[model samples]
Target: MFELTAALIVFLFPLAYSPGPGNMFFAANGARFGFAATLPASVGYHVATLLVTLAIGFGFETTLQRSPILFQVIKWAGSAYVLYLAWKLFRAHAIDKVGEARPAGMWGGAVLLLLNPKAYVIIALMFSQFLEVAASSGEVIAVGWISSVFTLNNLVAFTVWTLVGGQIAGLFRDEAQAHLLNRVFGSVLALVALWMMFG
Candidate 1:
């Protein structure tokens, strides 16, 4: 139990804190919407991630590690989505134009997770690492526990990011700065999407 806990904490801390598409989105949204407004999206993003990651941990990761074609297909798919999101964001209206209003809620967060490449990669790597670690103990329970820890920690980490984003929201009082922030974030998302697809 101790080993599993330690391993999970170690793996997830770096994984969650590292810059990724999801984190970037959180930052962007936070800057635009405020942390409280982004909470639902943050929660949704983690939940959706939990679903996809569990799937990967149990099945998809191993399959992809084995099949080059399958791996490439998913990679390309992820990349394509990122590019699509980028185009959409590039076209999205600037954030500052709104009259002291928050954007739409958690649904947007869910959508962002579904579109995020960094989320996928984080899951894939965790799956692989946990599987490797679990080999020594020959225990499925350890795997389950570790996965749960990772999931919970992921939620916490994302929430923290959203809070940071919310803090950023306070920095810009005008529409122009907000719009610039949005475009920058959008560009970053597109770049991440490209990495997911082709890299």
Candidate 2:
């Protein structure tokens, strides 16, 4: 159990903190909106993360393993959604613009997590690596610990990235600079989507 807990911390710390679509989206929204405005989406994303983690821990991995095509479909769908987000970010007007340039909301964040191929894969891997079949009680306890760790780590990571984005926004006070930064984020998001689809 100690070994499992240590391994989970080592593995999940980097995975949760690393640059990913979810983190990037939060950062972008934080910049476009503000940290306070991004909270609802953050909450939604973490809720989805917890639910997905629980699902994977409780035998959903077998279901996924049996249906490779389902994985492919999800990958494609997730990629498409990411691309759509990229397009939206790319076309985002000045932050000061009053109409139609709103930041992503709670549902947007939840949907992003629901469609995130990486999130599914990571959760599956975590369970496969840490869960034991015979030790039912221990497994349940481990899963509870894992879920808590994952949620806490994700909250910290997302908040830090959001703060960074807000700082970046401060740096890019000029409308043109902000626009350019938004386009850069859009391009990065597109690249991430492509990587998800093909890598």
Candidate 3:
């Protein structure tokens, strides 16, 4: 149990803190819409992610791993969707201009889970590295324990980032600064998509 706990914490720390498309998008939304508005999206995103992790741990991962073409297809599709999100973020109204609420609903978040390569890698690695550490009898319990802990950690980390973005949203009352911020984050998303495709 101690070893499993330690392994789970180590994995959670890096996976939760690392900047990815989800984090970036959440931050951007928080900046555009206050944390209050971004809360649903954040919740939906992590919930969907947790569901995927659980599914993968249970055996869906084997199917994904065995089918190279299917993996590649999902990967490319997800990357393309991210790129589209970047464009949308870039085109959003200026910070000072009154804008509608962000559209990242529960389904949107679920769809993102499918496309997020970081999620794919983390799920694959978690099962490979951490599950191996457990005894055969400990496998099922370990997967559930580790996944629940990591999901909680992930939610907290991204919520904090979203709150920070909401706070910073006020700092960019200037249209120029807001535009620059959007461009920069959009560029980052584009880069991430390229990396997932080629890296």
Candidate 4:
């Protein structure tokens, strides 16, 4: 149990907080919209995260391992969807005021997490690293506890990124500055999508 707790903090922290498609999307949304408007999507994303973590901890990883082609299909589909999001961000016009831009809704957030290849990989890794085989009771407890910790950590990391985006938006008072920021974030998202496809 101690080992599992330590692993969750040591491994999951970097995994959840590091720059990735989900985090980047939240940041972009925060910059485009505002923190208040981004809550629904954030909630949806974290809920999906919890579900995925539980699924993997409960043995979904074996199913995924047996079907490599299925994983590939998911990777490609998710990459394509992320590319579409990047295109939207790239083409978005700067709003005169914050929170005026249309934000991705709860459904979009759910879909993003459902198809996110990185999320799958991270959950699988967490379970593989932390779950024990000898004790069923301990395993059950660890699953629940670890899943909760992962979900909570994810919520915090994403919210921080969102707030960072909001701060960036606040800084870019001029239309041209905001426009440039959007283009940069959009390009970064596109690159992340490409990495998902080939990396």
Candidate 5:
């Protein structure tokens, strides 16, 4: 099954490594806060990714396939939520105490997982490509393995992105630089939100 594992990694690499919602969210948090501070949100997101992806692999794939409008509704709601987050970041202070300009935390991560349309679509596509079309002999085991791989891949991507953001933030030498960086991150998040909404 090394072939299957290798194929799965190859398929997941672009999706996981690219700057999607999860990566962007963590990057913004890591830029504003610190890497350690974003841990709760990361843990929450990855855990939910495992659970949600497994559920989709097992049965929820058909439900999403049948309800196209429902996906649109979720897309709008999630985009709005991410936009709100961007607004908050836009108003963020340059150098604040802990919890003043707080991170998204666990609930935000979980909510993003449920609302983010790309997430559902990606999981569904992965299942269709790997589980449905290819015809695995052991579906239960395969689904579980797929879920784990997806979660682990995402965790690594988020970690790297968070570190990248942290490094950018580290380059700030003064309040002015920090403020500029904060606004830049906010703009990036806003653009990402809009793309998710309309793109």
Candidate 6:
């Protein structure tokens, strides 16, 4: 079991650790607002991730497979939301003036996950790959176990990115440099949104 879990960890490293939409979202928020302010969004995202990943593992993949259009709708809608956030990030208040903007709430995070096609694809693939491994081990690992690990990995990654973003922003004493940093994060998110939609 430990060996299989180690393998699963290895498989998830790049996926969870790499800067994706979720991680970038929190990082940008942390830069604009703060890490504490982004926690609700993180909670929303991970909770949704847990439910959706389990659903996919339990049989939702069959439904998604049968309806490609459903998945496409989710993709486009989520991408639009991401682009909207990127626009907001582009015009976000600098850290010195953080009171003017509000961080995204729990609902925003949950909706982002629920509508994100890329998340569904990754969850489905994770099940396929890890479940296949578990089958060879002659031991059954529940979907809950896999989902928890994925969620925890993501939380760790998001936390790191958020703190790092905040720390970098903290280093900039001048408002102009801080604003530029926010825009850079916004640009990164814009690119990530485009990748999610069209890449």
Clashes of each: 1, 0, 0, 0, 0, 0
lDDT of 6 by residue, 29-93 (tens): 88777889888998998899888988898889999999999989899998899989898888875
Candidate with best TM-score: 5
Answer with 1 or 6, whichever has the higher lDDT. Answer: 6
Q: Tens-digit lDDT track for model 3 on 1-199?
A: 7877776787678767778777777777888777777767776788888888888888888898799788888889888988888888787766667766365877777777777766877887887877777646576787787678767877887887788778887888788888887787678778877877777
Model 4: residues with Cα > 4 Å off, grouped in runs: 1-3, 97-101, 133-137
Off by over 4 Å in 6: 135-141
User: Each prediction's Cα RMSD?
Assistant: 3.4, 2.0, 1.9, 2.1, 1.6, 1.9
* Minimal lDDT window, size 10, model 3: 94-103
**What TM-score does candidate 6 reach?**
0.93
Model 1, 152-182: lDDT tens digits are: 8877777777788777767766667766666
lDDT of 5 by residue, 1-199 (tens): 5677789889999998887778888888888888998999998888889989999988987887799999899999999988888888877767443456777788888888888999998998888778753356588888988888888988999999999988888887377888787788888889989999998
Against the correct fold, how does model 3 do in TM-score? 0.90
Give the TM-score comparing model 4 with the true structure, all chains together.
0.92
Residue 86, candidate 1: Cα error in Å is: 3.3
Model 2 CA deviation exceeding 4 Å by range: 1-6, 133-137
Estimated TM-score per prediction? 0.77, 0.92, 0.90, 0.92, 0.94, 0.93
Off by over 4 Å in 3: 99-101, 135-137
Please list the C-alpha lDDT of all candidates, in the order they appear: 0.68, 0.82, 0.78, 0.84, 0.84, 0.84
Whole-model lDDT for model 1 versus the true structure? 0.68
